[model samples]
Target: MLQTRVIIILLIVLNIFHETTAYIFDVNYSYKYSTKKTVYSSVFLQQNKKDFRFLAGAPKTDNILICNTTVCKSFAFSSQNEAGFEMLGAAIAAGNTVGDPTYICAPHYIVLPSFRINGRCFALHENFKPIYSLDNRLQQVKAYNGSYEFYYAQGQVGFSAKYVEDNEFLLGAPGVLSWKGTVIKHTDLNIKNILQPEKVAEKNSYLGYAIEFGEYYFGGRKRRCAIGGAPRGDNLLGQVSLI
Candidate 1:
């Protein structure tokens, strides 16, 4: 009976291995883009019905490439043609559906004249054209008397982002407030910064490393909330905060 059980287990293992190998070896389509010094560090894949599209970030060139089955097109912010302003495609986010608005971020963007390192993000139209910039650098700098004193207060606004609903999303600035991190809620008519009330004397917690939206029940009523991750929080052990 033991011998029979061993044979059955061996057969099952062999079957599973065969299926895995077959799936691994199967390839339907592949695409590659050549670049001189740029690396496709971040990528996003979107699908609609039966069509697939891909978006790749090229930080070195400060550009993004959007590709379909046939061709890939490059995009850049024409007005922001300055050096050291890389990280254009560091973060990308869109809604679950195909027709939803898409956002591309440059987390290290530098404001001119003052050279303040306030990050910027853009919302793209369906044709991949930038509709408007969600920049609060002027207002933020004004609050600090026209200059940022510390590195953490610079407000690298677009380090991370997540889409919640129509014309609404969350933007992360993991460098704000001594790296404790902050999230900005962007709506059609308002932009609000959400900061942690309790201050951590130590720096570099990076609370907004990632973000998402969740729904829960409170008093039997459904409530939606924002969640963020701080991988360096709690003495480098990490923590997730619900907002």
Candidate 2:
């Protein structure tokens, strides 16, 4: 009886080995974790070669539908075209999808140069920040949707950031340059459950014509710095798109 059991175990092991090695290896990937899975290889026209997608191995033959996940409820906003405190307010008040263009140039901080329009080294007017969804919002305020996602803010994985600042070692001033003016924010988001999801009322625009103005001043002004006439918002307006 023990000899029979050993023979059966050996046959099982060999069957498993045969099934595993039947796969045709591709030079692109050799995944031990993912095998025999279907991956969409048709590239999106808007995507670059860097965005190619492929299964680690063979596509599974199936007669029935099977999926590991369901598409999460979502809203894909084209982003608002306004800037400054208005942008933040609109996002909070009109909960849907928000997306801001390149915020690196958004008027975040400002430094005064050798000149000023009126008084103070630099003058700031629009720093008005209304309470919203971050840790700073009102006590009763919540995200109004699904609980916070652990993987959503996982440190810039899907997208990449490019630094446009000048080389730090080769600078004329003592410290880095500071700038300020207006700031804009927009994003794309999805409600976890659409059936009973939070309903954001139908509105023309959340935060429109919003503007923020601020300034920065340091001790003395050997070097002058100011960031005015920054690029205005575009592609946001009332153009809302669904993903």
Candidate 3:
């Protein structure tokens, strides 16, 4: 099951005609949540209030590490803004001084240690290209090229990896939501569940993985959603869906 808490902070009004296609210029944060037995979680969020932008994500695993009980493992695929400046991989590899070193460039150019303990876990991958300009933005702040974070407790834990495609971003740099459009109009269309297959599931044979889950929260709270696409393969990409 999934639990969501949405708080609207302010008000907003559109500045153009209905014809202006909505555009997300910048993003503050996007996150996912999940649990163990359920197997998958379908999550979505949107900016019902003014100023906020459409930002949402699906929990990559069945365990919600925030509980601190069951272990969690999963991977995510994403990209940073092609026009933004972001650090590649060195930062993540810096936090821990544990494990022995080993490297590989096949699937992706990455380096991992042979063994690691808590406070010593680490994995490195490219973040995205530079997100901000060196001359104008680098001096003010520094962000990762992209981020791939893994969470676990002990005993048994899963895995997680996310790829942030350069142009697969929606929010604007820092303050701007989008150079395109910020205002939103709600549609009765439901969100796409990330944990379930787009097609219906059948007995004995299922798509992806199996999970038991449910959601907690009612219309009393607010939600958000975004539209995007993933690369299918062979130079072809998939259709755009709400994230």
Candidate 4:
């Protein structure tokens, strides 16, 4: 009798597990948005006063889709005259709270005239309208052989981004300095690179491939730090740095 009871309980548990797995794998309950071969790349959710919005990046078209419960609207890049300015929605980040600004990045955006490939990011207002670009538009001029040449950021900025605080964020440029990578700390008043290649051997390490902020205990005290991932560091063994 004891053995028979144990068998009945085991059969009941197995039946439950089978039903749960079948439900999870059912395709009839899923929703399909696009039939094209485009990647919906990045996604973000924003909350307004009482409503929520869904934002998706469509890199193939250089556009962003802002969706509510009812419909989705497309917003195209404002500056399209520059050649090779692609991948507008490669990265997306939002402010800490609702109604805060939204950031959208295009890691392949090319600067005109000089044709620099520093990439660009747009800051959207609370209403999802672009306020301005976060990248500095200044270009350094150099005199070479009696001719003037313009130089801008060629580090491929906007490959990754994260919101830190009010009017502050971090941007990644994995292509900077022969793919050694670097992270930029941007605030309302200034923007500067916080990560640099410490040695020539660090090249191709890709230090700023990803980043995040977290709190950790050190010396029995809690401290906040920015963490960066170098997936190709140390002969592809990968490394994580804290700042």
Worst 10 residues of 4 by lDDT: 126-135
Model 2 Cα displacement at 221 (Å)?
Answer: 54
Estimate, for each residue in 107-160, the C-alpha lDDT of model 1 and write its tens digit. Answer: 787766666556777776555444334344434422233655344336677788
Candidate 3 residue-wise lDDT at 49: 29
Cα misplacement distance, residue 62 of candidate 3 (Å):
32
lDDT of candidate 4 over 119-199, digit per residue (tens): 777787643444233235554333434775432346667788887777788887776665777777877788777865444
lDDT of each: 0.72, 0.20, 0.21, 0.72
Worst 10 residues of 2 by lDDT: 168-177
Instruction: Give all TM-scores, in the order shown.
Output: 0.78, 0.13, 0.16, 0.76
lDDT winner between candidates 1 and 3: 1
Per-residue error for 179 in candidate 4, Å, reads 1.1
Ranking by lDDT: 1, 4, 3, 2
Pick by TM-score: 1 or 4, better one: 1
Predict model 1's lDDT versus the native: 0.72
- What's the true lDDT of residue 187 in model 2? 27
Which scores better on lDDT, 3 or 4? 4
lDDT of 2 by residue, 59-161 (tens): 1121111111231111112222222111110111111112211111111111124111110000001122211111111311223335532111111110111
Q: Per-residue alpha-carbon lDDT of model 3 for 67-117, expressed as tens digits?
A: 112333333333222322111221111111112121100111112231211
Candidate 4 yields a Cα-based lDDT of 0.72
Better of 3 and 4 by TM-score: 4
TM-score of 3: 0.16
